[model samples]
Target: DTAVSQTPKYLVTQMGNDKSIKCEQNLGHDTMYWYKQDSKKFLKIMFSYNNKELIINETVPNRFSPKSPDKAHLNLHINSLELGDSAVYFCASSQLKGTDLYEQYFGPGTRLTVT
Candidate 1:
């Protein structure tokens, strides 16, 4: 079974469009997160949820929102897409906080291109 998966690995569209990227994990993890990797390859956490509870990281934009229907699935919804939104989005999961390494297993990234 796939530990993590995302749909529409490549998305291209003009500015001001709304798009959503879906994600799912089967590792039985309680915590899931959405990360944005900019062109410079800097990984930034956009949002996280543990047991369907939202945990906001202050640095992220309010335009982005994450919805977790259950512990196994977390989805990202982006509004009014902009050129600055072009980047690779990665979905990841970990068993819980304070675990050793707590290494995030990432899915094949969804690349969003806004023109």
Candidate 2:
């Protein structure tokens, strides 16, 4: 079984459109995170949820939101999508210890294109 999976593998939308990406992990992990990888291939953490509680929230724009319905599902909603929001969004889950990570598993990623 896949440890982590994201839906809508590819998304294309015009500027100002709103879209959502869904992620699911079956690794029985308690901590999940969302990361954005830009064209330069730099990864930045956007949000982290531990046991369905908001833990680490980065300085992301208000247009971007992260929601965790349960331990295994995390969803991202983007409003007023801009050209700069065109990047690969990754969903990851790991057994977290304080500020450390263990056995982190990542989804293939959802590539978003804002035209």
lDDT by residue (tens digit), candidate 1, 35-77: 9999999998888898999875547667888899999999999
Q: Highest TM-score among the candidates is held by which one?
A: 2
**Model 2 spans > 4 angstroms off:** 97-100
lDDT of 1: 0.89
Output the worst ten-in-a-row residue range by lDDT, candidate 2. Answer: 95-104
| Every candidate's CA RMSD | 1.3, 1.4
Would you list the clashing residue pairs of candidate 1? Answer: none
Task: Quote model 2's TM-score.
Answer: 0.94
**lDDT score for candidate 2 against the true structure:** 0.93
* TM-score against native, each model: 0.93, 0.94
lDDT of 2 by residue, 29-115 (tens): 889999999999999999999989989899999999899999899999999999999999999998777655756799999999999
For candidate 1, what's the RMSD? 1.3
